[model samples]
Each structure stands twice: as C-alpha cells, then as structure tokens.
Target chain A: MTEIPTTRRLDGHSALITGAGVGMGRSHALALAEAGAAIVVQDIVAETAEETAGLVRERGAKAHVMVCDISDVAAVNAGVEAARADLGPIDILVNNAGISGGMAKFDDIDEAYFDRVVAIHLKGTFFAAKAVLPDMRAKGWGRIVNVSSIDGMVGCPSSAHYCAAKAGVLGLAKAWAKEFAPWGITVNAVAPGYIDTPMMDGLLDDAGKAAHVAARIPLGRMGVAADLTAAIAFLVSEEAGFITGQTISPNGGEVIVGF
Target chain B: MTENSTNQPANSRFDGQVALITGSGKGMGRSHAETLAARGARIVVQDVDRAAAEETADSLRAAGGDPILAIADVSDVGAFAEAIRAVEAAAGRIDILVNNAGIAGGSPAMEEIDEANYDRMFDVHVKGAFFATKAVLPGMKARGGGKIVNIASVAAMGAVGSRAHYCAAKGAVLAMTKSWALEFAPWKINVNCVSPGWVMTPMVHAVTTAEWRKTHIDAEIPLGRYAEPWEVSALVAFLCSAEADFITGQTVSPNGGQVIVGI
Candidate 1:
C-alpha cells in the first residue's frame, strides 16, 4: 500500500505552556511541539522546565525555557514577556501548572493555606492571561486552554480549596470567552480525572492506593498523561475555532453530566 | 480547498470521505453538506421533498462532484432507516452523517403546546435522528469508524419562547450524544452535537418576517446577525474530520455570543 500523506493541522503555530516542568504540562508541551508548534516552556522548577524545552527542541520545533513561580504576579509577567521576545507572540497558552496537596478537612485548612491554593491555581492563570491578553487581542486569533480538574465539576471529599480554585478557572474562561469573541480569541477549559501523572504517583505510591482509585473510575483504570495531551492539541489547533466556551472532560468516562 | 482520501487518513483524519446531510434541502443542513463535499467528501443530498433534495445534489454534482439523492420523511422511522440503507448501499460507506432535519413548533405557552405538536417535533428532530443513527451504527462500527453530528440548538442549552417541547426534544438529543460518544469511541466513531445559534433558516423564515427578524432575533445575537448556515456547517465538518478523534462526548456551539453560563 502506498503511504497516505497526511497534513499536520496545527502547522506553524506557536504555543506557551506554564508548569511545563512536569506532569501534564510537560506532556502537552511535547505533544504540541510534535504537532508543529514552536514551544515556550516554563516551570517553577528550573531543571524540569529546561528538560521540557530540550524535548520540544528535539522534536524539531524552536523551544525556549523560563523558570518562574507562576504564583507570583511579577514573575509570571516577566516570564511571559521573556518568552514572547524570544520565540514570537504566542498563539496558544496552556495554563496547566497547578498544585494538589493531599486531602485535608475544610475546617482544618487555614486561611493562609487556602490562599496559597488560590495563588497558584487561580491567580497564576489570571496573571499569565493578563500578560498575554494584549498580544492575543492584537493578533485577532488566539487559543487559551485552561487546565481544570474533574474536581471542579464534581466535588472530592477533602479538596475544598482545590475544587474551588479549579472551578474558578472554569468561570474565568467562560467570562473571557464572551468578552473576547469579537477579537477572535477563544477560551476553553479541559477537566481531566485521575490521570497517571507524577502528582498521582506520589500519593498512590503503594499498589493498594493506586488500585483503589483506579477501581472507582468507570474505565477501570486511571488516565495517562498522553490521554489529556491528545485532547489539548485538538483544542488549541485551528480546527477547534467553533469550540470555544466549552469544557471538554477527557476523564475516561468519569464525569457523566450531559448538557 | 483541500483534497482527502475516502478511507480516513492513517492519523485517522476524515481524509477522502463523503457525507449525507438531511434537511439540507436548505439552511444549516445544506451548509454542512456543501462544506464537507468541498473538503473531499462525496455528498449524499437528503431531504423530505425529492425535487429539493435532487436540486441540492445537482448543485454538488455541477461543482465537479458526485452526490446521491436521499429523500424521506425523517419523522417516520421506517423512512429514515430506509434512507440510511440506500445511502450505505449506493455510497458503499457512510463516512459522516449530519442530522439536521428539524422544524419549529409554536404555541402561546407551554400549557397550550398540545401533545400532538410535542410528539411531532420529537418524531422528526429526536426520534428520527435516533433511528437513523441506530441504523448506521452497525455499518459504521463494522467499517471501523464514522462520524455523526447531531444538530442541536441553543434552545436545548437554555429556555426559549413557547418552546418547552422543542427544548425537551433537543435536550434528549444532547444527552444521547454523550452516551453514544462514549459507547462508540472505542470503534473510532466520534459522535458529537453541534448546537447552533439563531441561524437564517426556513424555520426562522416561517416564524418571523424580515422586519421582526431584524429586531427580535438579530438583535439578541452577539454577532448582530443570524448565523449563515455555512458557519455552523464548517464547525460540524471539522468535528467529523480526523483532527477531532479525541474530541468525542462534546457539544460544540457556534453561537455568536451566547455562553453556557454554568455546567
């Protein structure tokens, strides 16, 4: 059989991903790069961020690395500006950097602790979006893919703060989608269920805990990072232009709420 | 603008393929059929009226393409099923289906909209689309993949005037889309719903005069004009393409500025 030539749908696009040092962010960075996007990779952890950048470069797309704590407004702004200057204006922005520390009772959680959760998950997203909004507005074409959690849609027992922040991100995306529709900027959110990321591995170190969580999922297994990366690539591509203001749940059939 | 093969590309994109769009006798349905045919999809022009359906098919044929006429009353299950059978037998395979056949029923209020009107809307928009998919599912599964785009409306997402029954029908369509998408994903059948905004369709034409449409429907749309059917069709074609394999169990809206507030 002759080989069927297929064109890459996302050719020549440029994408910037935050928290690309590890977990889902790193996977999405590499995936987008593979699909022909020049990548700007950022991670709170310097080494991991550089590693992700190297991976993108190896995949034949230009890659730049920036190390910044996205939770800090000043740092997030500086990092975005640096990346823009180095790689060109970003057409896609993946707000994938987030933290989910183990379960804690709502009453037991202090204000400071809750504030930190909002800082990284919610505040970081706003600041990064603020940094890139003008450029996105100028281009008249942009795709902002915010990474939310299944917790945002459905509550988890001991994750009040985590759930609230992710849920806030969903609200943020919807409001911005309406505001930016005229400018051709699309905003969307992706909520993933228990995926096999480094974050999950840390909590489910023992076989028993991992098995317990996997059993609860309808698919009988947790999702892999690649599962979500596949979806992220589609949403950020040109094909998904009409798909804005929607939240796609690639949770292996976990959250079953229909329109 | 681009040419694709019929087998769906190796990456599994809807490369060279064909689709049949019903209710495409005009409006949004016609838009989807034409757009897909432009992208290398053989067109199966389907409609209730034989002449209208043939007219749409002829246009596609005249444009350096071949299309088959698929005529039937979608409200009738047997008629819908037979239409799918004919399309499959003639086209050899149904790479895509756009369930865009629909009507708008009006009443003073929910209480006034009697059972007959309610059932009529369900028969064509919901039940008709249901059996059509059921008939094609096996063929699509056997062929190793397919795409089905259910034409839902924003009315399903929110409330509209005297449309309780219509809303109920589209709501069922939206729910059915999720269940079907999950069931069919493994077989590579990507089932999705495209909920269009207020569009310039015959249904709109019947309910409102040009003057009324300008003030009532057009003003409410964030984009300030009823969507041309082609805009809605373009999105549906993208979903049917291989580019959207990972995007099952989703509802894509092309409403100018109407946002689904929550959930």
Candidate 2:
C-alpha cells in the first residue's frame, strides 16, 4: 500500500560535463542522459567527445559537443556560450577534467610542470565554473560538481601538484557555495578513490588489481565508473537541493576524513 | 568501494527496503517517515509514546503507507536494542536508520543550567544515537551493507547561549558519524550526518513567538526563511538512497546558508 513518488526525472534540465569523452566523465554523461537531461559533452579531443555525445543522443536526449581547453578563460567562455546557443543555458556543470602527472618529489619537480598541473586541475575548474555562473545566477538555480581525488582529501605520496590542485578545488567550491547560495546555486565536490577508469589503464591489470585490493582497499575491489557517477547524478539532481560545499569520497574506504 | 547499491528507478528511492527511524512521533522524524513511505519504503516508526506513535501510523495509513509502530525510548540502550531485534525478526532486515530523536531546552543562562537538563540532553541526543547504531551494526555488518543518517543541528558549528549542552551533544553526533563512516565502510555501510539550520518544526514552534520567528527567519537566514520539514526530509531520503553509496564520512548542512564551514 506504499505510494511511490510520481516522478523524479530531469526532463527539462540541460547539463554540460567537462572531459566527457571517456572514463568517469563519459559514464556521468550517460547516467544523466538516462535521467532525461540534455547534455553538452566537453572534451579537448574532438573524436572522443563526439563519441560520448553520440551515446547521449542514443538515449534520446539532446547532445552537443563543446571542444575547448578548460584552463583557458577565453576559450572556455566562448565554448560555453556556443554550447548554450546550441542546447540552452549552461546551468549544470561537472568539472571532471583533470591530469594526474607522474610522481615528483618536492625538490625534483620544476616550476613549469607544477604550474601546468595547477592550471588543469585548479584553474580549469575555476574558469569553467565562472563561465556557467551567469545562466545559473539569472535563473536562480544551478548545480556544480568539482571532481576531486582521494588524494585531495588525504595527501598521497608523490604527485604533490595533483594533490594541491585537487585540494584547492574544494576550497573554491566551498567559497562559491556560501557566496552563491542566495542565487539557489549549490556547489559540491566528489573525490573518487582508485577507480577503474581509462585514466588507470596502466595499473589495472588483474594481478595489480588483486594485490592492491587485498592490501589496502576495505571494499575488496577497485571501484568502477558508475560508483562515482551515481554520486554525481545525485548531487546535480533536484533531490540534493539542501546539500552544498561538501565533498563525498567514493574511495572503496581507502581514505576517511570527517569533521 | 562497494560501487554503491545499484542506481534505483527514478520513481522509488527505497522500494522494498525496510527503514527504521527513531523519534518518529512528531516533527522531523515523522516527516522523514512519511517521505520514505511515499517513496516505497516499509517504515518502522519507533517512538516511546504509544498514542503519539499511533497518530503517526494513522497519518501514514491515510497516505496509503502501512507503517509498523515500535514503541521504545532510545535513551534506554537495552530496551532499544530489543526493539530493534523485534523489527529485524518481523521485517527481514533494516536497510536504513534515521536517528532523529532529540529534546530541547530554552534555558535562562549557563549558571542556571541544572545537572538534570545537562544529563538528559546527553542521554537522549548522544547516547541514544550511539547505542541505537550499536544495536543495528551487527545486523548491517552481517548483511553486508546499509545506510545510516544521523540528525544534527547547525548550533554545532556556531554559538548558542544557554544551549552549550545541546550543542555539545549534537557535536558528538557529528564527530561519531565520522568514526562510524570509517569503521563501517568495509561493510558497505555509509554513515553520514545532516546538520540542519533552523527548520519549521513543532519543537521550534513551541519555543518561539511569531515575531521572534519572523525576525530570525527573515533577517538572519540567507534563504529568507527556515527550511520546511519536507526539505530536511528530502536530504535524509537522498543519503539513504543508493545514489549516495560512495558518500561516507560526509556531513551535509541544510541550513539555508545560515552557517557555511569548509571541511
């Protein structure tokens, strides 16, 4: 005799995901598509970006391709404007684009490499969010999810630049959450653990996966793309209206930090 | 790590799941029960008072939800655990637990605060939530996964005069939620906290006058009003949903931008 909710579909919403060509980004694109959101798949690579867009279109949702380097302010602004013209106002943004550079000690890493890492992870998120804020502010409703890493929550060994940029990204989201709450905008972050995505292709062989799963992860296996996407789908959905400025880590219980 | 419990259909977040919520006689707890019931969860409405609990059950029946009433005071650890066992015996298993039972105090000053009020605050808010969680953990661990959402207050992040005991108690809830998240992560149990700001509840209504409520609701809160109970219930429902599987050790505040603090 339970009365289920009438509907929880995102029939009228338009979303844009950065680096949606593959891995977690592509998975998120598909998940949102299933929920009935028109999608703008943004990736620097045109070929893969179009692939994700095609998948979105297959689900019967409108799909647009936005190809641009998110770190560059002018390029991101222009790209978003074009996407809005093709699709609609860019209200939902998922800053899922990031580069995990090779391991480098504090002294071994040079300034340019660090700056580049920061540019992609930290600056890329900042500029992309800046580009979409206009539509959200005007409409008085927006949802933004900054894709961080487990290393961001608990500093990992090596990759200092990646960790710093990822951690700083959360700071930016929290600042925006407080500043933009009046506009009905909610900004949050998702820090995934050792997820089995295209980014981890090199280390995801059967042997490596088994050894790592037994030694560290409490959940006994590496996470898949859907694990991260489920959280993102929830954050951007209307059901998550009250939550903001917080980070949810889907790391197979690898890193645990709380207040 | 467990990849969450697969994504559910758009219509039902619970559907066939059993949810046991404490302090469901009235206010936020009752609202949470109604929300989950509407979304297809079998609710175990736990409250100490039979009359109040039955009223909630009647409301649920009116809404087409058949809710089971479990009468037990959460402050009594032994009785509460037995009640939880009774629920497990009847409902197969409990998939979600919402610790929403708490008391209030509008005291004159800290100097006038009595030992009885201080102890009662800790007994209900802190111990009640803690032991109830303890009772459910064995079943949850054996079953491999579950969701636990503890209710906290925005006062934990800010100062409230003469309510230091309440704040301290709620603060402990937030702190232990982190530990539970870490401790129970391996079992696929996600423990999180929802620290609400001001909300339109019977508790708030009984304590404040119209002018006072208006002054705070209009001038203080950034959203220009206190949250409706359903708004708070929406968040609790989300955390219990499979979509929040990877989200452990996280504390979300639904305070209408009244208090914003970074983790």
Candidate 3:
C-alpha cells in the first residue's frame, strides 16, 4: 500500500478560522496548524475559542483566540485586526461560522429569522473576506474558503433562508476570486453534505434521523469534519494557486450539483 | 512554458500508480500526462495518432518515467476497450483514467449543424467517456478504489455560439459523471469533472486567431487571460490524488471566472 505522505505545506503561513470552537471550524484549525500554519481560533464562545487555541498549541503551532459574533461586521473586522496583530498577516481565512436557522415553509419564515441567517452566512462571509483582503493584497497571496452547504446548491424543503444564504456564499466567493486574482489571492467554497457534527445533532431529532440522512448518501455514511478539512487543506495549499473561483463539494456523492 | 514551478517540491501522491490519459498526444491531455508522470505515475499515453502517442511516451521515458503508448481512437468502443486491457495488463493495474479526448467543430449555427458533426461530437466526448469508464470499472472495483476525471467545458452550463453540439456533449459527460459517481460510490471509486474555460492550447489556437481571441474571448474573462494547460492539469492532479478522496460528482471549473459571471 502506498502511504500518503504528509508535509508542512503551509509552513510560515497564518490562518484565521471562524466558528473554530467546534465542528468543521475546529477541524480546519487543527488541520491547518498540523500543516504548520499559525492559527487564530475565533468563535462566539470564549471558552471554546481558547480550547481550540490550546489544541493548536498541542500541534506545536502558535495560536490566538478571538471571541466575537461573526454576524456583526464591526466585531468581525476588529477580531480580524486583533488576530493579525497577534499572529502577523493572515494568509488564509475560513468563513465557517453559520447557523441552520429555523425550519419553516418559505411563506412562514419571519423577516428576522431570514435576516439573521443571511447576516451570519452570507453577509458575515463578505465582511470577513473584506477585512482580510488588505493584508492579503499587500502580501500578494492569500486563500479564502467559504463553507456553503449542499442544501444551497439543491434546495431543501423548510430551509429557504439557510439555503439562500449558503448559495450567496458561493456567489461571494466567485466574485472575490475574480476581483482579487490580480493580487494572487484565491477564493473558493466547500459545500459539505450531512456532516457528523454538533450542528447535525441540532438538525436531527435523534440517531434515527441521522441514520436516515446517512442512508441517502451514496457513500453510505455521513461525512466527518475531516472529510471537509482535507478538501480545505488542499485548496489552501501553495500548489493550489491556480484553482480559484471554484466550489468543491465533498458531499459523499449525495448531490452532483454543477457551478 | 514550464508546466510546473521548479521551486516547489514534487508531490508523490501518485507514486506507484498507473494513469491512462486519453488524447495524451498534445494540449491539455499531454499536460495531464506530464504532471502525473512527474508525480511518480507510470504513463499510459493513449491517442488516435500512433506517432503522437509514441512522442508523449518517449518524453515521459526521457524524464525518468516508465511509459507505454496505446494507440486507439476513443470514439471506437472496441479499440478503446482493447487499449484499456493492454494498459492494465502492461501496468498491472489502472489507478487513474482521464477521459480527455475531444474535438472542437467549426462554430456553425445550431441549425446548420449536420448529423455528421453532431454524431462525431457526441461519439468522441460522450460515448468515448462512457465506454472508457465501463472498461475500467471492474478493475477499480476489484482493487478497492480508483479515480476517474472527465474533462468538460464551461459551455455545458451555459450557451456558446455555434457549438451547441459540443455543449450538449459536455453536458452529457457531466450527467454521466454524476451517475457513475453514484453507482461507484460503494466501490470507493471517485468520479469528477473538470470544466475549463478557454484554455490556451494548440487546438484552441487552430480554431481562433490571436486577434479575435484577444478582442472577443479574452475580454470576457475576468482574469484577463486564458488558462495555461498546466493550470487545468494541476486541478486534475489534485483530483486524482489522495487529497481528493472525499470529492466526487463535482464539476470544478478553473475558467478565470468566465462562467461564474455568466459570460
């Protein structure tokens, strides 16, 4: 058997991950740290951010913690600046913070709920990307990976707000990829399907619901955070410079959506 | 132009792997072959032109790679199957298959397209990929897992003038890619599509003049330039590696933001 060799592909780089306290965000932070990048673990919960920072430290990489709500533009900008002050210029940014929002029919969705979901997933992605662009533009290199959902690509019933916001993330990523390509920045999106995370627990009523969702996946299982982390790692690597404005769906063959 | 930067260390993700790239004689297919071979894959260069296939294999051998030439027109199912068998027998196993053989027809209006042009387009792009996958599936299943990458175009998603046949064929390729991805998931085989915009290849050059390309095609692209063959190959190499083990049924387009802006 040929073993896949692991290397410090992101050595000397700095990364800031939103929602890094748990789930896919935490996984990305650790993976980036393992690849030799200093990490800025940002989340709404201070304790979880610190925990993620400690995990990064365990991997022998420097880490900083930031506790702020991603949906707030001012807070995101401030957090990004603070992260840069502590860890130097951020070379990578993962917009992984998002909320599933309430499941309701399109007509039943309230204005507040729709706005909140859009604020966190779509607007938050825009704000974070905007905050990091100056540093990346100055350095002439950067990588941004937005976390969209398979629901965004193929509409899901009772999740109109969530799906719309996720779809907006894809558009934001592509627009930024084009606008920033001259500065050597690459923007991409990762659409994960039915990941086994705390978020999944919140969405599913029980183990049976989770199993039912898993059964629908052609790969015969729900994706783990590591599955998405691997794709993000590849997209943010030095060799992946040419791949920009693309959406890589690591959905276990659940949906074959094209962009 | 050099396909890869010399400063970067060679990725050995495909070490001890065998890759069979259709239409490997020139352009993007050649780039795919070179990139994979450089990454430690033994090359099975398949093309309709025997001389071109030999040329690609010879270059691989010169670069300290083990390569074999297989001459078979991809549109011919029988010949293509034989070619696959020969490669599998020679290389011991086929670890990767790139369904990249394609032809571009003159951009005649859709109404003006005859049966011959339409059939040829579908035969080479759609049927070729279908039969190639059919031939490689059993071995991949027996061996536990493998990778298959089909080359598609941005036209599949949107319209392109005078190339309706080409667009339709690529769309079929995308559809088939998804179907195979679903069917092969249990066997652990990953299937994906690479939809490139206007890449700077000899075939592209043969089709359009530099002046027209600059004023029309290049202007529409946000990156303000067409992709180098290596740029397309880089994504294919990534898709074929262990890094993309979780990726399947995805159409990753490296089009300089052409299709994204709906151009």
Task: Please list the C-alpha lDDT of all candidates, in the order they appear.
Answer: 0.76, 0.83, 0.83
lDDT of 1 by residue, B1-263 (tens): 33333322234334467686868776666667666766678887888888777777776776667888878888777877887898888878887888888886754487787888878989988888888788788888898888888988888886777678888899888988888877876677877888887777667778789898778644565434566655576568667776555456677777655646444
Candidates' DockQ values? 0.21, 0.37, 0.33
TM-score of each: 0.81, 0.91, 0.88
lDDT by residue (tens digit), candidate 3, B1-263 = 33332323333358889998999987778889988876788988999998888888878887778888889999899988998898888889998999999987867897888999999999999999999889888899999899999999888876787689998999999898888898998988999988888788777778788898889654677666787777678788878887677778888888776777321
TM-score of 3: 0.88
For every model shown, the clashing-pair count is 8, 1, 0
Instruction: Between candidates 2 and 3, name the one with more favorable lDDT.
Output: 3
Which number leads on lDDT? 3
Ranking the candidates on TM-score from highest down gives 2, 3, 1
lDDT of 2 by residue, B1-263 (tens): 11122334553368889899899988788888988877778999999988889988998888767788889989999999999999899888998999999887765477766899899999999999999999889989999999999999888876777678888999999888888887888898988888988887777888889999888866766655677777788778878887666667777787766776645
Error in Å for residue A80 of model 1:
1.7
**How good is the docking of model 2, as DockQ?**
0.37
The ten-residue window of minimal lDDT in model 3 chain A covers: A1-10
What's the C-alpha lDDT at position A1 in model 3? 13
lDDT tens string, model 3, A141-244? 89999999888888788789999998899888888888888788888888988788898787677776657655777777777888888788878886556567
Docking class for model 2 is: acceptable
Q: List the residue pairs that clash in candidate 3.
A: none
Cα RMSD (Å) between model 2 and the true structure?
3.8
